[model samples]
Target: MTTNTPLIELTAWMRGRLAERVARLIDAGHDPHTGPDLIITPLGTTGEPGTRADRSCDRCGRFVSQGCILYMITVQAAPRVLCVGGLCGACRRLEDGWQA
Candidate 1:
């Protein structure tokens, strides 16, 4: 359990960053759900660590090719910590007012 503290902290930090970005987008009159400029850092994997492979975007259900950037999202819904891949960078930044 203690070994996972760092990963948990990292996840929390990432979530906070996402929240801030979303707030900024909202203030700018943009819909965050339609933007892909948000950064998604991959935390520790649910499978073997350090192993890389192609994955699908959990949000849009699109296949993400290898070498493409995939965002890692961790959702805590009580009694469960669901980790899933989010949109690819291009898809994530498709909306106006997206930074980066």
Candidate 2:
């Protein structure tokens, strides 16, 4: 639990990032809202201490060779949604999981 960093600011930042991420998905011919969550885990960032999660679409699930987008959903903890595209990807041999 990293202290000294406010949670609100983190969440707000996450929201903005998430918004952009979803937008990028739309640009890449994918539905942001429809993408299924591929992974969920507590974020371990040094500064951005929030909930970092992973998600992907059907095609992305197969085509994506890296890890799922390293995104943080802090709406409940903070107030924003942060999603970084091309951040992470999923693994096929891992059995329904990502290595973010």
Best by lDDT: 1
Q: What tens digits encode model 2's per-residue C-alpha lDDT throughout 5-72?
A: 43333334344544555555567665434334322212222223232222332212322233434332
Whole-model alpha-carbon lDDT for candidate 2: 0.33
Cα lDDT of model 1 by residue, 13-98, tens digit: 44564455456546767554443343233332233433333365433456666777776545432121323445566545532125
lDDT of 2 at 63: 26
**By summed lDDT, which 10 consecutive residues of candidate 2 come out lowest?**
38-47
Taken over the whole model, the C-alpha lDDT of each candidate is 0.44, 0.33
Q: How many Å off is the CA of 83 in candidate 1?
A: 4.1
Q: How many clashing pairs in candidate 1?
A: 3
Off by over 4 Å in 2: 1-10, 35-100
Q: What TM-score, computed on C-alpha atoms, does each candidate reach? A: 0.32, 0.28
Candidate 1 collision pairs: 35-92, 36-92, 36-93
